[model samples]
Target: MPAPSFMGIYPADSVQEVHSSLPLDPLGPGAADLLAGDVEFRLHYLLQEAKKFMVHGKRTTLMPEDIEHAMEALNIEPVIVPPRPLPQAPFLAVPVPSGTSGAQQQLYTVVDDEIDFATYLKEPLPPALANSAGVKWKAHWLAVEGVQPAIPENPAPSSRAGPSRLPAPTTGAASLRPSAKQHLTTELQLYFSRLTAALIPTLAQLPNLPGNSTPSAPQYSFPDAERHRLAALASVRSDAAVAGILAYLVRWVAESINKTLMGATGTIGCLVDVVEAILDNDVLFVEPYLHQFLGPLLSILLTVPLGPHPPPSGMTPTTIELRTRAADVLAKLVTLYANGYPGLVPRLLSTFKKALTSSPFPSPLGSDYPPAGRYEGAVLGIGACGAHAVREAIWGTNGDGLRSINDLIGLLYPGEGRRNKAPLVRATMRALQQLTTPKPEGATVPPPDSAEVAEVFGPHFVRAFEKRPWQAQELMRLRKGSNGDAAAVQADAAGEEDEEMEEVQA
Candidate 1:
């Protein structure tokens, strides 16, 4: 069939035909129109791509195989073609009743080959394998020094497909071998295909074939793709047999996160979910690749503005939600690996502190100031790393960082006191509360005088806990006996050590 003009916009009816062919309910006209637009765009893209393959092949005329090559390169499922073309069946014309009385019309239809059921039944019955319960089994060494021995339990080598026939990770047919590509099995390739089709589908659904996004984006998460995504996440979470592709999955998550963090793409809420799934999967051996996730997670948490330009109304909703979600995953990951990997908590705590307190060279607020959204994320990250981080990281030696934080909060909520001013102030106070003893919800612990609260935890805490005396009292009781300025110097010494250690490790 000739390809449609890439610029031509399709109507809902065209998209409906695709649904009808697949046994799915016809899409709503609105959705169909949107899909039609996307389909037209892909068709245009596919034609341009096919021309490249045609040029490379030095052919002026496009071949069926050239189109197939373009589809495969775009991650589309290429249509398999037979090596030898079959002869076409001749069309038969039969007389059919026309508009009126004696007039007749001829209708053309293919005369398909018919079979005799009686003869087919009498000829033979195909053999069937026994059920699992009925089958006999025996165990043997399938391979000794990487060679499978042919036996009653094993298939003959001649009948089995080998590594040379299997698709390589790259385009390396010659370089791929059983020994060299031990883990790159057919199963792994299938797993990758399905997983990519589920999570990042835009490319897979190219030319409007079965597929999302550049793997299909629901403006293309077609119902089936959404289900596939959930099932894939569940498999990664609970399946114990996927070690061969664990590294690949890790890189996939990091890459998705980078694309969004670097502003090259949009929110990867699914990748955040993937990270959480992997972190929750206790069965997986993830320690080796644990560091791979940190860079991307931190980038999401601390990258300023999160996009090319800040919205006039301030941080966008998507940006806020992503930062919040990334912070939670970072916390779970850091807490999980903290004990085995010493200095993990403190290192992250230091990093968050720098973002929270230090402004870069071209700061609008000043060199001492940082972006408000990033600072808020820093507080959330520090809280996630560990609650104890507030003492050494936030309070600082003699409360220097806390002083800067208090000034920022005061500037944000000018003339405000006696209540939580904003989410940032709330987050900072909550981190401080972590260092205090827990008070029951019903218990009424009288707060310290405003002067004393400011003296102990700095003025920011005073602003944060002004009305909530329970939180204020907790900080007062815990910090009363501690030497304030002197112990801060000691904590500063420890904070410096964490900084130096993180630098060395990096």
Candidate 2:
């Protein structure tokens, strides 16, 4: 029977031809259509089964083995077909060219010969080649006498031929070296003694002498011995005795603060130098003694009248300068140890508030209290803490911080026509500027925007400045200008200032 045709897929003539080849009975009417559909369905089923086998072997393309495996899995017996011999074609021969060399002819003949893998495997391996000459090795002195030969083993001639003249000490010698503790202690004591003597004003000099009779106050000097001591201390790498030495130094400074304030500018400067030297020493970490050192350092920074009070002014220029120095030191300490001492920023903010908020004590003469150096120090200290610390400390969870900032801002104008507060006002303004300005380098987070500042202090900012007309100018100055305008203005002002100075000189 003949099979029906699928549209373009299977032709009716081909199916009829195939059916006629098979030795079967005559076809029924619908037999061809049923047979064609059944053959198509069976082919699709076989292909799907073969694909499963292909995937199981982790292959993309289908192989003959996959079809065989699919037939086995589906319980379908594969049809076995006898292999047929391939037909062979007669070889055609060509005559060699008359100009060809014998060597080239031999190469062509070798290529035409049939290769037998079994015969080649049966052949014995070839013998090794004989050595052409006897082996020899010779040695020679790399260095002749004192001068070394310019060989690969030796360094370049420009480099040192031997070890340096002053060779580093060996472990044995280093172990025998004497401890520097005792020497450092002696030097520190001597330096502090000299510093104290120079800083403390004598009773004879205490009473202001008429005219120039009162000789110039003694200047604080760093002697060679003191410098050597500081160098030794800085060189000491061991942290073992550092705590004790730091404590002793802190004690000396604390004791001298009172006497030094009696016109001991030189002593204060010397003390500041010592503190800076200690801070600069990488080997000595003062984290452990931070609390102990903070008290004395803050005393220097926030002391009311740094110099003698009986003088014309409560705070002299030297005293103000010392206060500024102390403030700088305090700021450095806070920056380095703030994380270790979590409460440090809060404590500093508190001290700043107290300095600005406390009413001035009545003087002996009943005159209005003069502005103290402590106010300046407090303002500088707050400014040095950086913007983030300033913001967090002043506007943290507690509302008191913002209140303090407001009080400080209020003190900028202090009513009743008193203008002696210019220094305090300037310091406060600087601190405020520091708080608002974004750090140009090494800042991890962007500074707070004007909106954030307004959100924090907006409610009280206007009210705080409303009563004080003088503060309006300061408030206006504190407001940040647009980036482009500020930059242009700064450049123009600098150029104009330079030109004016040059014209005046001419």
The most accurate candidate by lDDT is 1
Candidate 2 residue spans exceeding 4 A from truth: 1-244, 312-316, 364-366, 370-372, 392-419, 436-506
For each candidate in the order shown, give its overall lDDT on alpha carbons: 0.65, 0.54
As a whole number from 0 to 100, the lDDT of residue 50 in candidate 1 is 93
Model 2: worst 10 consecutive residues (lDDT sum): 168-177
Model 2 per-residue lDDT tens digits across residues 39-130: 67667778897998799899999987777666654445544521233234445454454464643222122225577989986975332111
Alpha-carbon TM-score of each model against the true structure:
0.50, 0.39
By TM-score, how accurate is candidate 1? 0.50
